[model samples]
Every structure is written in C-alpha cells, then in structure tokens.
Target chain A: MAHSEDVDHTSHGQSMGLLRVLGPAHVWALGVGIVLVGEYMGWNFAVGKGGAYAALIACWFAGVLYSCVAMIDSEVTSTVAAAGGQYTQAKHIIGPLMAFNVGLYLVFAYTMLEAGNAITLGFLVDTVAGMTGHEGGLDQRPFIVLAIMFLAWLNYRGVLATLTFNLVITAIAFSAIIVMFLATSPLLGAGEMLHKDLMSGQASLPYGWLGILAAMHFGLWYYLGIEGTTQAAEEVRSPARSLPFGTLAGIMTLLIAATLTWYVCSGLLPWEYLGDGVNGAVAPLFSAAQISGSNALVWLLGIGTLFATLASANGCINDASRAWFSMGRDHYLPAWFGAVHPVYRTPYRAIIFLVPIALIFALGAPLDQVITFSILSGLLGYTFMPINMIMFRKKWPLDTIKRGYEHPLHPLPAISLMALCSVTYFAVFLGYGTQLIAMIGFYIVVSLWFHFWRYRFVKRADQFTMPWPRPRGY
Target chain B: MMDTWNYIEYGAWALSALFGLLIVIDWIKIDTTYSEEALTSSREGELEAMTEKHRLEG
Candidate 1:
C-alpha cells in the first residue's frame, strides 16, 4: 500500500487536490495582504501626477472600478470554483489563447508586485539603519533576496499556514491605518488639515482635466490586487458563499482605507512636498508622523509599513504561484511545474521558479517603473473582465446554473468597468505610451506562440475542467 | 579588514543561499521521485473526464 502524508482520506497516487480548508477570513486576508502595502507608499504617486485634488478624484473613480470588478469576479469565481482565477474563467468562457494571455497577465502582475514589495523591504531596512546611528546604511540586495526566499518557503509549506499568517499580519497592518486616522484626529476639524488650501492655484487643477486623467494610473495602487482573492477560489471551503462575501468585504475595507489614507497624507503635507520628485518623502506615512512630532505615531506607522510590505510580498508569492501552477496543470506551460508537494499540498515548483525572477525585478528594475509595470499588467487582466462577464452570462444564463452570488446591475458593472479601463488606459498613455504598447505587443507575440505551438500539447476535450453543461450555442 | 555591516551583509547572503539550496534540493528530489504521469494528474483533469462521460451519455 502506498503511504500518504496529506489530505488523509485521499490515496497516495490518485488525483491529489489542493487542500480545501480556507474560509472567508482567509480570502479577505489573501486579497488585503496583497494590496494593503499600496496604502503605505505607491498611492501618493497619484499626488505626484495630479496634485492633491485630482488624486482624490482618481481615488473615488478607482473606487467605482473596484466595486464593479469585485462583483464580476465574485460571481464567476464562485460559480467556476478554481485556481488561476481569471485564467480559468477565460479558458472556460473564451478559448485557449485568451486564457493563455490572462494567465500570463496574472503571473506578471503579482510577480512584479512581489518584487516591488521585496525592494520596499530592503529600503525600509536601510532607512532604519540610518535612524539607528548606522550612517552609511546597510546594503539592500541580500535583504531583498531573503524576503523573496522566506515568503516562497512559507508558500512552499502549505496554503493554510501562508494565508493564516497573511490574516494576522494584514489585520495588524490595516489597524495601523485605523490607528493613524485616530491619532491624526483630522475629524476634530481644527487646523489639523489644509483642506482650505486644497483648492489653491495650481495645486487643485494644475494640469487641467489632463491631470485627473494622469492620476488615474497611480490611483490603481489603492486597490490593485484585491481581485487576487479569487485566485484562491479553489482552496476555499464554500467558494459560493465565501468568495463573494470575502471579496466584497475586502473591497469595502480597501475603499475606507484608501480614503482615510488620502485624507491623512494630503491633510498633513503640502501637495508639493507630498508628491515632489527630487525632495519628496518616499514613505508618506512616516513623513506625516515626523511632521506630527509624535514618537508613538512614528514607531506605529514604521512597524505598520514593514508588516504591510511583508504581507504584500507573501501574498504575491501565493497568488503568482497559483496562476503559474494552474497554467502548468493545463499544459499552457511545462507539465513539470504542475506537481503539488505530496506532503504540503502546495505548488512547490512554481514557488521556487518565481524566486529568481522576482529577485531580478527587485534588484535590477527601478522602483516607480517596476510598480507601473505591475499596474499595467493588472490593467491588462482587468481589460478582459467586461468580455469575460458578458460572455459568461451568455454561455450560462442565470437559469442554467446555481451561482454563489449574482451581482445586481448585470451589464452596468461590466460597462462601467470597460469605461473606467478605457480612461485609465488613456491616463497611462499620456505618460508611458511606449511601455504600454510594448507590453501589449509582448502578450500578443506570446499568445501567437501558444496558439501555434503549445495548443497541440493541451488536450482539447480535457481543457474544459468545469462540470457544467456545454456552453450555450456551442 | 571587513567591517561589521559587511559581515551582516555576508551573513544575510549566506542565509539566502542556504534557502535557495534547500529549494533546489527538494525540487530535484520531487522530479526524481514522482512519475511525469502521477505528477501532472490533477483534480481538474479528473473532472474533465467526468464531464466527457456525462456528455457522451446525454
């Protein structure tokens, strides 16, 4: 008799599955962990683009984008119930080529974010070293590599421990925001904030309507990876109920966090200082704490930044590995990557593969540029959402199947997502037009390669993994 | 004469190398132990086969 170590009831050799033990809390943790890091740093870059006022406009506009995405994602993910999230959805809804592109988008988006997170960890350490009397500052290369490896190890062990750790750290990081809000006491309505000065001269409408358009690019930092919750759809115990509940809750939490973050930062610093180039503060929250002259606030926000960074990196490893593993299982990539760890029931190979790739991104790429690449990758994935939702509803009409959650305003969310994505695309184009076109061209070339070469390896009949009936009109 | 921060840097690099080695070792072990067929057979494939059967019967 073959012995088994994981999922006790399943035999050693037959069809082992990922552990299905996650709940709504784990889903929230996964999504929030991947995204909360943005609150600490990147969102302030919107201030760089559009000043304080335009950045606020981008924030709420992005909020609308988040709601639609959450709704559309929850519905499909709950009904489909698989890893690879959008990749799996596209495979079933569209065809293999679209699926291939979506899968690559998911992988790159998270991997880039993971790399950004690791670099931020190194920067945080260097800053701390200087603060603690080490003037020359420690090198960040090893710490960056170490962060990637450590998180990969956590992911390698098992999903349960990894996401549970995410839950604890994500909760603490989020509470730091809450604590900052309370400490700043902006609601006291005294001269605590420069709300009066918000509309002064160029600060409010510096670049005309174009500034608000430009800010939308960095606005994504506020809620970029919340959609990653669905990547863990396969592992959730009750994907139908838990997927929607956890995802909706995650988006709502981020919405509140983003608004408060904008208020706190913009209130404390002048628009110019908050979003400056040569002399700007990199860590906006820490800068705010410094301005406040509160030792307690400084320490809390500092630790919060560290925990949020680690949590984001850890969650990135988890989601990116799942997307890559899902592709491998389907033969879109090498089958060698499809293996799950027999003992840990994790995607060990994919986790290992991403370590060096993310390390290169961390050590080699510039910070703001790497983050923009991440946002663009995410946008590519989101651009597919409207098409995915529309086709999904067409293929499996509401009466045809049991859905965990049906989003109200069926085509409205889908249409809204498309419009917002178009505006954001133009926003990115205003700035990084060359890189944007290059990324799309790269995906197209890869998709062609898959169509001509890799499709033969995938068993056409076997690719339809969901047990649902044949799609309508097929 | 290496300084203190340099040693700390070297130590961190060593720990990272150790982790990488562990991962590579486990990776090679799994590749050698499991058959290509066994490793790639997933829950999704099983479900796909089930659907194929159901479609045939229907």
Candidate 2:
C-alpha cells in the first residue's frame, strides 16, 4: 500500500507548502469576499428573462439550493480539509478522471469569473467617466490587463495579506450596498417599480415558463462563488470547525445582501430598464443613488462597485491558483504548475499562468456571455458534490472518519442538491445553447488531452503526498 | 398602499443595515494573533508530530 509517507514533497521546491494561518473570520471574509460582487452586479440580468417578481422567486430558489449545498459542503470539507475544494473531495470519492475534469472546470469557472469582473470593472469605469462628463473612458483592454496583473501580484504576496485586504475591501463593498439600499428607500414611491408592464419590452419573457428557466442561470449569480471558499480548506487554522462556521455565516450574509439588493434595485427602477443590454443591467443601483440627488451616494456606489470588482477578481485568483496548485501537486498537470514560490510559500506559478488566460477571455467576451459561460462551468463542476457525498457515505461509513459537522438530512439534502444541479445544468444549456455547446467541446478536448498526454507524465512522475499533517494512527 | 410598500422597503433596508453592522463588529473583534507567523510555525510543529506518529503506526 502506498501510504502518504512514501509520497514525495520536494518536487515543488517547497518543503511545507501553503502555510495554514486562516481562521473562521478569514474564511468568512473569503466566502463573502468572493461572492460580494454578485450582490452588486450580474444579477439584474435575471430581471430581463423573468420580470422582477419572477426573478425574485428565482433568487429565493437559488438561495435555498445554496443553503442546502453549503450545509453538505461544510460537512464534506471539514472531513476532507483539502485545498482543491470540490475537485479534491471528488478525487477521494470518485476516480482521478472525474477529479481531473472537475478540477479543470473549476479553474475555468474561476478564471472566467475573474475575466467577467475585469470586463464589468471596465464598463463601470466607463459609466462613471461618462456620467462625470469626462472625455473618453479608460480603454477596456489595457485596464483589464492591468487589473488582472495587480490582483495576481496581491495573491502572490501571501494568503494572510490576501485575506486581510479582502476583509477591508469586502466591508467597504458591503457598506456601499447597504448605503445604496438605504438611499433608495425614499425613492420607491415615485415609480411603478413593483408592478411594471412586464411583457411590453423587447427583452420580455416571450417563452413564458421557459424564460423563467432561463432566468435561473442569471439568478444563480446571487450566490455563485459561495462554494469557492472551501478551496481555502488547506490554509484555514481548523478546517473542521472554522470551515462550517465561516461557510454558514457567509451564506447568511449573502442571502441578506442579495435580498436587500434585489428588493431595492427592482423597486427603484423598472424591470424592463434593469433587463436591457449592458447599461440597463448595471444602471439600477447607480440610478437609485442618483434619485436621491446625493453625489456622495453616487460616488460611494461607483467606488464600492470598483472595490467589489477588485474583491471578486482577487478572490477568484486565490481560488483558481489553489485548485491549479492541487492538480499540479497530484501530477494531474505539469509539475511546474505545482511549484510554490520559495519565499512567498504561495503557488506563484499557477497564479502567473492563469492571469493571461483570464485577460484574454476578458478582452474577447461580453459580460453576459462571460457570465453564462462561468455559470455553466461552475454548475457542471458542482454536479459532482451529491454523487461524491453518496459515495463517501458508502465508502467510509459515518463513524470511520472524524467529522467536523454533519448535515441534518443525511442523503436527502445531497439528493436534493444533485437534482437542483441537474435541473440548473439543463436550464443553462437550453438557455445558452451555442455557448454551452462550445464549453462542452472545450471540456471534451481538455479531457482527451489529459487522458492521452497528461496521464503519462503523471505516471512517470513520483506520486506527490498531501502536504498537511494528518491525524495520528490513521 | 404605496406608503405600506415604502415602509416595507425601509424595513428591509434597516434589517440589512443591522446585519452589516453585526458583521463589521465581528470582524473588528476577531483576534488577529492566530495568523501570526510565530504561532503558525508552532501549530505546524504540533501537527507534524501528530502525523509522524501516524506514519510510524502505519
């Protein structure tokens, strides 16, 4: 039997790899930090497909789905306590093939989200400049490149610095949303925001129930990256305890923030206006602040939106790098990708390689396409969770491993999550047929390359061991 | 009717503000000492010892 002791650690040039310094607060920061921007933007597109009320229902459904998934994730992550998040958990339960695909899909999802943030940030800067009567706004390409580079550099510093920065910025971003909501409360009586003509607009729900299904993809934006926090399992101080506390807390925060944001934005602007193309999608909150004629609130919303973008991009880099690092460590990817910076003790190589790819995607794709692609990839990767949970229960039996937290409804929650993921995956496919096909083709090509080319290299290389210390007498 | 709806929106905003305040307070009260390098090294040592014992048993 190849025990963990026999596995090599020096292939990556780091002896102890990825210092464990994060606590529940840091985890909460990461959990909320990563998904904070979602509360700010990308969610209004749902208003386009399903009017405000339908979008709100979709948001509630997504919230319930996430709440269930978070509970199960807390249980699984606390037990596994690995860096790869779903990818690593899938590895222990499913085979290496599923792990490889899931890992790549996760990296793609995070990178695409990072790209989406960069693009959205560019739009926001342009919007602000346009509003202020500035000449031409900053060029999107150069701005996105610079932003991705800056975030990658911040991540390279260390996880502590990353989380600390995340905490401060996340607080500011959340404050901005609250301020927007409070400022917009008095303006709600002026417009028919609640009972708007839903079917009059071009982007109206033409396909009826199918349109609501399509809206589910955009609705998912409210809680899209909440699961990404589990990727910090390795760095956290006590994975079993802190992971659950942080994840649950983060979910609650997101739910409250999402509800407030949707309620305010929908009530402040007509659903038809909120659902229009790019400007329509992002203008609700800013327009709301403008309604109060408070320049300070407008500036706050602008600055807060920028910080929210930064937080999302920065957090995605952290997640994508760690997932890539784990794959490299396992020899599923090249050993070079697994290399940690000797000084920073961070996965510097993975972070560097991923930024250019994110920049390329950001420069090429529009916001809605980028968001749709990310949602599809993320949901595809999430499909593994329920299966993994069922397989784990059967493999280890409950009492075998030291469990940090347990889900209330054993297989039921896992089953429900699986059903939700499946339905959502199909919904995304039906809504984004061409884009989904393209993504599926990309996955197939990557999987084929992994099997033929990557598997050989991994077999040739010595097996890499888990870097974290395991419990005694395993 | 509009007044009722406006009050409800105001109530939601107030609740959101309360939640945000609590989160900020928790963040402020959190102990940063655990993340210090010295403490991290100490914990790593302890974990290393525990894992070494497991390796020996295996």
Candidate 3:
C-alpha cells in the first residue's frame, strides 16, 4: 500500500521550504476566522428569504452539507497534503483541465471573499462613525484599501504571525456571539423574545420548502470558508493529524455559532423586521442588540462585527495567495508568482500580486454582487469534490493506498455532498439566475484560456508529486 | 474640536499608499536579487520531478 503523509523536511540549507510553523490551532484559526464574520451579519439575509423558520432550517441544512464537506475534505486533503486545497486534489485525482478550472474557483472564490471582507471592514468603520452622529460619512474606499494592503503586508511577512493574529480576533468575535446568546437567555426565559408569537403569525415559512431552499443560499454564510482550513495543508506541522482535527473542529465551531446566531436573532428581532425584503439585513445582529436595549451588547456586537470582518480579510489573503502561489509553482500562471521569500519563507510575490486584484474587487463591485460571486464560485468548487472522491478511490483502491485519514461511509458522504450542492445551486438560481449563468460563462472562458495557451507553460509530468502506485487498471 | 475621523480617513489613504509602495519596492529588490529559477524551484519541485510520472494528462 502507498503511504501518504506530509514529508517534514529539515533545512539542509537556510532558504529552501515553506516554514512549517502552523499547528492545528493555526489551522482552526484560519478556517473559523474566515467564517465567523458570517454569523455577525450576512447569514441573517436567509431570514429575509424564507422567514426566520426557513433561515433556521437552512442553517441546519447547511450544517449537514458542510459537515459532509469537511469529512470528505479531511480525507482527500490528508492524502494530498499540498497548499492549493481542492485545486491540488483536482490536479492529482482528475486532470490538468479540471485542475485549471478548480484552481480558478479557489483563487476567484477566496479573492472575491477577501475583497468583500475588506469592503465590509470599511462599512463597519462607517457604521461606527455614523453611530457617533458624525458630521459626514467617511469615504469607505480608503478604509477598504487600508485593510487589504495591511493584511496583504501581514501575509507577505510570514504565515505563523498572520494566522496567530487571526486566532486572537477570531476567538474574540466568536466570544461575542456566545455572549449575545447568553445576554438574551433571560428574555427567552421570561418569554420576552416574542419568537413564539412571531412564528405563529408571519415568521413562519412564507414560501414553504422553496423558501427553505432559497434560504440555503444565504444559509451558506454560516460556514462558507470553513473548508479553507485545508488550504494550509502544506504548512501544517503534521498534515495527517492537524488537517482532520482542525477542519472537523472548525466545522463544529461554525455549526454551534450558526445555531446560536439564528436562535438569538430570530428571538430578538420582530417578525416583520427579520425578513423585510428580497435583500435583507443591513446588520442584523447589531440591529438585534439595539432592540435588546443594551448599549453594552450593541457595542460588543459592533466590535465583534469589526473584528470578524478583519479576521475574514486576513484569512482570505492567506488562503488566496497560497492557492495562487501553488498554481504558479505548477506553472499554471507566470513562474514569478511561485517565488517564496528567501527570508520569510512566504509566497511574497503572489501575496503582492493579488493586492491590486483584491483592491479592484473591493472598490468596484457592489457588496451583494461580490458576495454572490464568491459564494457561487465556492459552490461550483464544492460540486467538484464528489467527482474527485469517486475518481480517487477508483484510481487507487483502499487496499492499494494508505490514506492519512480515510472518511467513513465512502460513497455516502460524496452522495450527500452532491445532493446538497444541487439544492444550493438551485437556491442560487432562484435569486441570481442571470449572475449564475454569467459565472458559468466566466469559468468556461478561463478553462479554454488555460487549455490553449497556459498549458504550454505548465510542466505537466512534473506536476504529479504524490508517491502512489499506478491506477488499478491504467 | 473638528471631527477627528477626517484625520483618520486621510491617514488611512496615506498608510495604504505607503504599504503599496513598500510592497512594490520589495518585489523589485527581490526580482533583482534572485534568478527566476532560484525563486520558483523548491524542494517540493524537486520531489515532483523525482517521483510520480504525470498520469492524468491535460
């Protein structure tokens, strides 16, 4: 059987490898930091879609989908043990054409998300300034630019420090959510939250099962980037142990956080206020705090919102640059992007290159459009997993290969993931039919571009680095 | 006192510009100092070349 584990290389010389400074804690921080921002704000938009009940259903549904994803990802990533996450999986399990597409998915998804988080960081600053009854609105551009450039600089310096910083802020943001739930626990006991009243009246599912499906779209916010933990596979001290623990732990954290967020927000906010329109929630948790009449809670939630946004942006920069750097290393893009800083042992060039691209995304696109693009790109990437899993097992059967962490109920997790993805894709279509089509066209064009021109630069035979036996038949 | 936020707004822009400039300078310096192969080639690349012939072709 072919054994798979990350080769821990001791430095023969001073300047050779990515510094394996990360532990499972850093891995958890990267995943949770990127996702806790959702609980602070965007997931509430699902309430706007199908009402509070629908949002709750969607949250749990999303939990199932992402749980399956984390399990399958742990299995594949533990074996692949590379930087690009799903992109690397696609390259080895599938082919170059699929890898190019999946690579674009990770790059675009994380880049757009980074941009969105930076943009939200600016908005958070604006909202805080507005709360103080400031004279005029600050230009969000400078704040957005500052956040992106600063995080990019952090990423360029080193991975260890960047993710350690993420750990601190992500934990703080997560704490605020827990505090919010506890603060409102009294109201729930006193029957003051009006949840029962609202559900009986209008807070019930308006669009029925269709609404729940629609809510699944925004429901994605709960754990959108938890899968990103796998992106740091190469840097982990022990990919075998850390990848499974961090990823599964990250998903579990998100599930708890998502449920608490839904419960608190639904109970606290009025039924009418919960899902006002197709585009819902300016800042739902902050709004919920205001309704609770606790200045302290409001401030805490506001600070939480800001920290979550910053953490998300920081994590996004870390992941996006890694994906881009891995692709460059494989010669999918210019080789310059593959360069590691001889001193810091970070992907300095890719980190710098993605700054302007993220800046463009942050400054130019509308938040809704940016978010939709990111989520759609992510959903498309999720679709590729089942195929990869099936192909992986077929290529190297269980008896022939030694996987680091083999997922149980092999075909079951893959099937559940595909079914969830199909539903989520439908949910996206219900709201963003036109955008969905456009995203497909965008990827199709990029795939063709890579196949025709970029393939020449890619060192095809050298790209397969895994030490495994040949396919069962081939 | 005038709204202090205005100062912060301007400072943010200045800081952003400075960071961008620094990254560019560092990028240029690194480019000048190292050859492309030196930057791109790593222990990982060496491993890829040594093992596992590319089976899943484009």
Candidate 4:
C-alpha cells in the first residue's frame, strides 16, 4: 500500500507538466501573445476621436498597472512554483477554496473572452463580406461556435499546434496594422482633422476625476493578459529567469508598437471624418481605407482583425486550460483536469472541459455583454494578483526566491495597481451595471461558501498561517 | 497603380529584411549570459532543497 505522502507527491508530479510544455521560447511566445491581446483590446476600440488622447492617457495608466502586475506575478510564480498557477498562489496564502473561486472567475473570464473576440471577428467578417457584395450575411452565433471549435481543436491537438497557429496569424495581424499606417497616412490632407462630436462636452465635466478614473475599466480590460507567460511555468526552461525577462520584453515591445500604431492611425484621418457617434470597433481602420480609396487596405484590415480575434481565442484557451490543470494538480479540482495526455503530454482533460463550456458560452450568450464582462472579471482577477503577492511576502519571507527584477518603488506599484483596478471596477459597474452586479455577486457568494467548505480541507492538509511578517533585509 | 503597389510592397520587404539582419548581428555581438550562471545554479539548489522539505512534510 502506498503512503499518503506518496500519493500527494505523485499528484504534484503530474501537475508539474507545465514545465514540460512551455519551455523558454514558448513562454516568450505566450508573453508576446498576451501583449497582442492587450493591443487588440485597446487599439480596436478607439481611433480618430477627441477622447483618443483621454483614452491614450487611460491606456498609459493601464500600462502602469501592467508593470506592477508583472512584478507581482513574477514574485508569486517564483515563490509558489506550483501548477495551480494563479489560483494555487492564492490558495497557498488565503485558503484552498479562495484559490478555487479565483480559478472559477478566471475560467469564466477567459471563456467569455473567447466569445468577445469571436463577436469582434463576426463584425469584421460581416463588414468585409458586405464590402465585397456577399449577401445573406454570416450568422454570428454559428461563426462564433465555429471559431471556438477551431481553437479547441488546435489546443486539443497540442501546444505546438496552438502556438504555431497563433504565431503565424499574429505576425500577419501586426503587419496589417503597419500597412494600415502607411496606407492611411496620406488621407490627412483630405479633410478637417477635428470634428465637433469628438468632444464629450463641457457638461460631462461634472463626472470629474471619478468619471475619468472610471475610464480605467476600458484601459484595464486592454491590459489583462500581461502575466500570461507564468501559466506555462513548468513547460518553460528556467522559468525563474525567463518569466520576468519574457514578460517585460513582450510588454515593452507592445508599448512601442501600440504607441506607433495608434499615433499613425489616429493621425492619418481627422477626428471628425471618422464616425464619432458610432461605437465602431474596427471603424478607424475602415475610415482610413475609405479615405485612401484602397479596397485592398480595407481587406487587409478586415483579415487582420479576424486573425487578431482568433489569436485572442487561441491564447485564452491555452492559458485557461493550464489554470485548470494547475488547480487539479493542487487537489482543489478533480484529478482528471490535471491529467496529461500520455502521448501529447498536454493537459488534455482541462482542454476538453474548457472547450465545451466555452462553446456553450459562445453559442448561448450575448456577445457584447460577454466581451465587457470578461474585461471586468479579468481586471478584478489582476487586482487580486498583487494583493496575493503582498500577502506572500508578509507571511513567507522567501528571500532566496526573489527574481532578477523588483518594483522600483515597492508598495507604490502595488498601491497604483490597486487604485487603477478600483477605478476600472467602479467604472465597469457604472458603464455595465447589470453584468458587474451579476459577476461581483457571483464572486462574493462563491468566495464565502468556498471558504467554509475549504476550511475542512485545510484542517486535513495545510495549517492556516496568519498574517505574514515583514522582512528586514531587502 | 500596379507599379506603385509593387514598389511599396518591395520597399516594406527590404526594410523588414534589413531589420532581421540587424537583430541577428546584435544577438551575435551581445553576451547575454552573465557569470551569474553560477549564482543561479546555487540558488536553484537551495530552492530544490526547500521544495523537497515541503514535499516530504505534506
């Protein structure tokens, strides 16, 4: 008969499959994929509007949040070094069930995120088809389900398949953005740059700093995927070194790319010529095409947006599955979720579980609400990430595990991330009340109930270590 | 129109190729691996030891 220790150790071993799948380059790719998601999330929504500057400022605030969260993520992944990924890190300090609830929320966020991107893809396809004189229009729900299934098949096939698919498409997507810049720049002389509708009006000023801060929700939604590299910790070679470097490198590259892309596109056409009242997701790119009189440019943008949205789905599936696998490894979820395909050596169970649920969501849910809700949940999850990091340092003074990098101003980054997230959370509530209330209510109820249930699990296994003490040496 | 499009396409390709060459050259020139390799090995050793303890206890 095997000892309990033996069984537990064996369980942990299976979850450690993360290291086998990710490796250094794949880890870097995951980071790059994350930034690509962020760029799509932020860049797709606004272009050639008076609020473009305001939105850019909001994006910068999100960039600050990104830098801070990156630090917090590196610390957690290094210290915990568990397959549970984010949730495992939470459970180690808070309790198992709290971690489980976090996992639930994250899964919810990523699945709906697939739907969101699919919805965006749906619009891109419809517009392009309209431009080409294709009739009867592609049904969005069916297309969304198709996208979810296509991504599921890729992820289910293996990590290499998923990464290759994303890598090729993402490269094309980035190139399309560059092409958009070049083609659109000549349109500046065609019309007036500033339109009256660009302004939110002086009357809107009463909303004040609070209102401006609330805008962070949209910005935070854009920046949610920065720490995606850590999910593949076990797959990556030398995660301790690669995780921080890769995360920062990908983020910096995105910042440069996004800044250039936004500036070029926004400047090419005047704020007035672009539809001010319309919440055209890929409207700016289209307007640029319209002025340039280039059908090819519009086609280029349409294809790029579709690929970008697909890449988002592909990336989300990979990260979300890994989260479940990690949770299963930690014994917080069913054992099957942690199981690796003996041949593929991938978390096949988790992939299977995620795909069906994701398909259900894509087929059944409203696309707009799914996208916005995913953004809000992602922001909430990221906010929790830093808090977990701060707690880890306090309770477990693991000096040896500190990364090559640390936040320059310590608590300042943590505090800033929290404040930024808080603003976004409130704004999400204000802008999207029904979704926010439903999600938050779900989180609170689930968290409290899980706490009581997990108490028994804790008593049987790990002790409830109290508030952690501050370390003296830096 | 075809001629103009071709020129633009070729110009972009040339720029991309040049950038790729530069990146390769820079990678060859830079010594990214520090002597901290030794320090890293030792630190990893310590972590393994700690994880080993937790594994045994849990």
Candidate 2, A136-158: lDDT as tens digits? 44444545666676677778768
What TM-score would each prediction reach against the true structure? 0.94, 0.82, 0.93, 0.76
Native-referenced Cα lDDT, model 3: 0.84
Q: lDDT for each of the candidates?
A: 0.86, 0.74, 0.84, 0.60
Chain A alone, TM-score per model: 0.96, 0.89, 0.94, 0.83
**Model 4: how far is A354 from its true place, Å?**
1.7
lDDT of 2: 0.74
> Candidate 4: misplaced stretches above 4 Å?
A1-25, A34-50, A182-211, A269-283, A402-404, A454-474, B1-58
Task: Kindly list the per-residue Cα lDDT of model 3 for residues A208-273, writing each as its tens digit.
Answer: 777787889988999999989988987998887999999999999999999988888888786457
Clashing pairs in 3: none
lDDT of 4 at B37: 19
Pairs clashing within candidate 2: none
TM-score winner between candidates 2 and 3: 3
Instruction: Write the candidate numbers in order of decreasing TM-score.
Output: 1, 3, 2, 4
User: What's the CA error at residue A153 for candidate 4, in Å?
Assistant: 1.4
**Cα RMSD to the true fold for all candidates:** 3.0, 11.1, 5.5, 11.5
lDDT of 1: 0.86
Q: On a 0 to 100 scale, what is the lDDT of residue B14 in model 3?
A: 98
- The candidate that wins on DockQ is 1
Query: Against the true structure, whose TM-score is highest?
Result: 1
By DockQ thresholds, what CAPRI class is model 4? incorrect
On TM-score, the stronger of 1 and 3 is: 1
